[model samples]
Target chain A: MRTHSAIAEPGAIRWTLTAFAVAFLALFVALPVASVFLQAFEHGPGAYLAALTDPEALSAIRLTLVAAALSVPLNTVFGVTAAWLIAKYDFAGRGVLLTLIDLPFAVSPVIAGLIFVLLFGAHGLLGPLLSRHEVRVIFAVPGIVLATTFVTFPFVVREVLPILESQGSDQEEAAVTLGASGLTVFFRVTLPRIKWGLLYGVILCNARAMGEFGAVSVVSGHIRGETNTMPLHVEILYNEYNFVGAFAVASLLALLALATLLAKRLLGDGSHGGQGQPGASQEAR
Target chain B: MSVTVRNLTKRFTASAGSPRAPAVADASFEAPDGAITTLLGPSGSGKTTVLRAIAGLEQPDSGTILLDGVDCTAIPARRRGVGFVFQGYALFAHMSVRDNIAFGLQVRKMPRKEIAERVDELLSLVQLEGLGARYPKQLSGGQQQRVAFARALATRPRVLLLDEPFGALDAQVRVELRSWLQRLHAQTHVTTLLVTHDQEEALELSQHVVLMRAGRIEQVGTPHDLYDHPSTPFVASFIGGATVLRGRVEGTRAAIGPLSVAAPDGALEGAGLQAFVRPHDVRIARATDQSAVSLGKIEKLVRVGGFVKVELRLPSGEAMTVQMAKTELDALGVAEGDRVLVDLLAAKVFVEDYSI
Candidate 1:
């Protein structure tokens, strides 16, 4: 029904609160984002296009894409597996395991990078073993990918776990009793039910993987056009007082964030309906 | 195919840290080939768990499950040719009715052409022919349950396990599905095991009922047998409208507060014995019948569904209920607060002592 609450705020107070929120958004969000674009084109579109096409900028873009391509799919698998395990089955230490899945979220990203360094750096614990095995993880592309994955590890699990928990294993069990094998049941039943949430999680994880600077910087060894990811490259240009170049690259990252927000808003409708009453989507139609 | 469970015991490690209590303890039952047998019990009585154990959804700590005389306890659920209709229906939300029905067949690697044919057959079988392209969420609750039924039966599994099949439907829909299921059962005659807490459902739909109490099988017999002869106090109260009474057993006769009936077999002389009398069995006896009758004050009277119910209190304050036709109530001239001579036509007294 009639869903609005009986209680009502005074008109003056409601308008004041609405205006206050709009002002806050304008000050904190709209201003900086607009300024980034304005600054990027200060020397006109010609210089803006040149900065974007710079060899180093192009290399940074490729490196960011490569890292995301490597880390995102791997993290997706890990995320789905973790969420499925936590949601469907119970075992000893399950609470501990669930808490540990959010280890990335709770730990500082810098600390995440340092932990990898300690384990894989030249003078660290397993460094000698890795070097002897002809592995260069701490200051290489692999290291950069690992650190990015570490920072964004929890996004998919966080999104997918609640959906799995709410959806329950009923359909999966129904599939099993219908003589569908476990893997078949997962692909045919479980995956489709959580498809929207899984997509949302992947988008979030990819956005973070591309924009993460603290962790990737520690592991990238600051190699220009080599290991520098987009965020690291943006930092280098800003530090060198190349305002137009820095803002151009920063504008790209900002656009990516904006796209993520739009996609989230779109998928958010489906995700909420997925967890709603069964006839929700039909009623929406 | 026939289904048999032997000495099944499954203990859930309690979430509150107590891990030793078995949810289904030593439950054993047999569903004869091509018949509907129901496991009837209250919530937490473990009837559904026993059904799940049979479907290979839950592994019993100690049990042997036999399907058509073949031990299949060690088999996984996907390999066990038993289809289970979940309590929540669990229809695939993403797939259309056709694809949902075709899922099992496709998973079994049936040819594409045969799957389409089978899907069409099942859609019509469930009377959902034209709705093949509709998603589960697009269907009504009854239609969704029917789709679930069709999906489960698509592969023609040897045994079918239905966990509270109508538990999710509202009153009118439940009544309709009950008969629909009966007709389906008659047509297919697949060996079925239904688990439900509703006594009327179990009594009406199943040929045999296994009554459970506190994770133990209390009695197993035909519905008529459970109603006519209950072996325990739990069965007497659980099966139908049997009002249990506190009484004492002397020789072969049990004496309730204001009435007496023949004690159930082996009910030796004892106090605190319970006598079970159905509402219809206790009626207004003739005034001059010379029966040892005690007067009871009608405490409450209400008309319910083709019959009049009179809840009475004896001199000793023991309460009893008797239901009779409205004509009978009128002919006897009994109303609320009227004192009348009550007689027990049928009473079951268990020999094994149990608190009322």
Candidate 2:
């Protein structure tokens, strides 16, 4: 057998390469954001508080949270059922259906926003039917929700499908043969088996739901205190040259992102413990 | 409680590049009530397929499965009133040991308090009273298997089906569990069908052993019957370790390896016949001073647990194994390259040679 030397790489080469990679990341990914954060905190906590408590910013934050809350639950249900159908059975057109579910991931977010517009906006297909019933989709919170839903639709399914496929159908069959009804087996056995993957998918969905901007921006109409989400509000403040206010709001959203990541870590740790098989448990597999 | 499988057949359609093969072919058998019937076969021999078909997991191509004279061919597994203890135990990993045992009762929508009481009862019955709160993963393999058994027995089904119940255990655990299973069967008196490839397990655990090959039944009989009066060459070779020697038969006698023995008549003179002899029946004899030792060399000596296997090469160069006691090894003076004489006392005779 060939032996490996247990020495570290040459210090100069390793340090140089590490420095180069760090410099690249700092320049490309971290510095611009750090500059914004530094600028935001430079003024004081009072300015940050003012920006957050501003009625328009508050409404925008509330609207974004509401839309995400509404979308995540529905998407979770859809994600789990769709994943179950795809992973368990061999039905005709299954491949086509899987591709269609993943289509949202590949499609441009702008086009996803536009598709809702073309279908629900005035002078578009079904626009007359929508207007006759006074069903306001465009320039509305529901419109923002629909766009965000479309853009983030694939996260849960993508995260969950592979886990379900690897878990095999034996446990479910055993449950059924042991006299569990279909629903009982699904809830009692099947759900527990893939709870971690499902939770992981939901975390991804939540992350995407919070960060989604492009799709929501197009359909939101940006009514200052009404339809504006935090992201749209961030864009509006920056455009109006209120740099300090913009950065403050952006900091709040960044904190929310950080909180989500912490939650992901906490939930991930718990669910990893819940997995069944020793080797295939989440800690390793 | 009896399970009657009639003309049961199942064919799995070929997928992609695989050839279509019948998993089960026109299998039929009756497992009597309160008796343990074992389905014995090697892997992929359709033994598990027969069990699964009986459990309603696989739909047979054309057949009827009746449990206690009730035609259950179209019934679902849940309603068939059959308890299936799967290989690997299949205990719910998330539930505590007590809750796992109580799952069937809960599924039947039993009263919550009664379910709790039954769970406690089963935990004690399985000798796991203190481990009630422990999950399946925390228990040992044997404990997990007992919990699985208790879980199956919770519903009090008419029949019990075990698929290689102890196959996943270590040798010592397997032997201990085998006797435990026999005692459990005696106590419950539920009609049971166990499928296993280990002949020793089948012989020791079941009242009746159904020997299967190529998706068909070769023989079904008690362990003693199958071992002593095997109906075919397959049964003879499979049940007991016996070797066959080819020879020709006359009216009442046959010429075998350096010896002539009386053969059952229906043996055509000058026709070929095969004699079956167990290794233990072959005795080692000392050659007289006047007669040179029948020239057979000791090719190999293998020490098995309590017995030593002495392999001898006949003058005809055919190899045969003779078992000798460790105590008698000194007098026999058997060693590699030593010439020895073997005498066949009584041997089974077959009209034709059938070896697989």
lDDT of 2 by residue, B205-240 (tens): 887998888787888889998887787777887876
**Among all candidates shown, the one with the greatest DockQ:** 1
- Say which docking band candidate 2 falls in: acceptable
Residue B93 of model 2, lDDT score: 73
Q: What does candidate 1's lDDT look like per residue over B1-356, in tens digits?
A: 99998999999886667896799999888889999999999999999889999988899999899999999999999899888898999888878788889989988899999999999999999999899988787799999999989999999989989999999889999999999999999999999999999999999998899999889999999999999988788898888878888788877788887678988666667756778889889867434443446877788888887788889787778788888898888788756766778888989876555656
Tens-digit lDDT track of model 2 for A119-155: 9999889899999999999899899899888887787
Candidate 1: the clashing residue pairs are none
Whole-model lDDT per candidate: 0.87, 0.82
In Å, residue A198's CA in model 2 sits off its true spot by 1.6
Off by over 4 Å in 1: A1-11, A266-285, B16-18, B265-267, B270-272, B285-293, B352-356
Candidate 2 achieves a global lDDT of 0.82
Query: Pairing residues by index, what is the TM-score of model 1?
Result: 0.94
The window of 10 residues in a row where model 2 chain B has the poorest summed lDDT is: B286-295
Q: Which candidate leads in TM-score? A: 1
Clash pairs, model 2 backbone: none
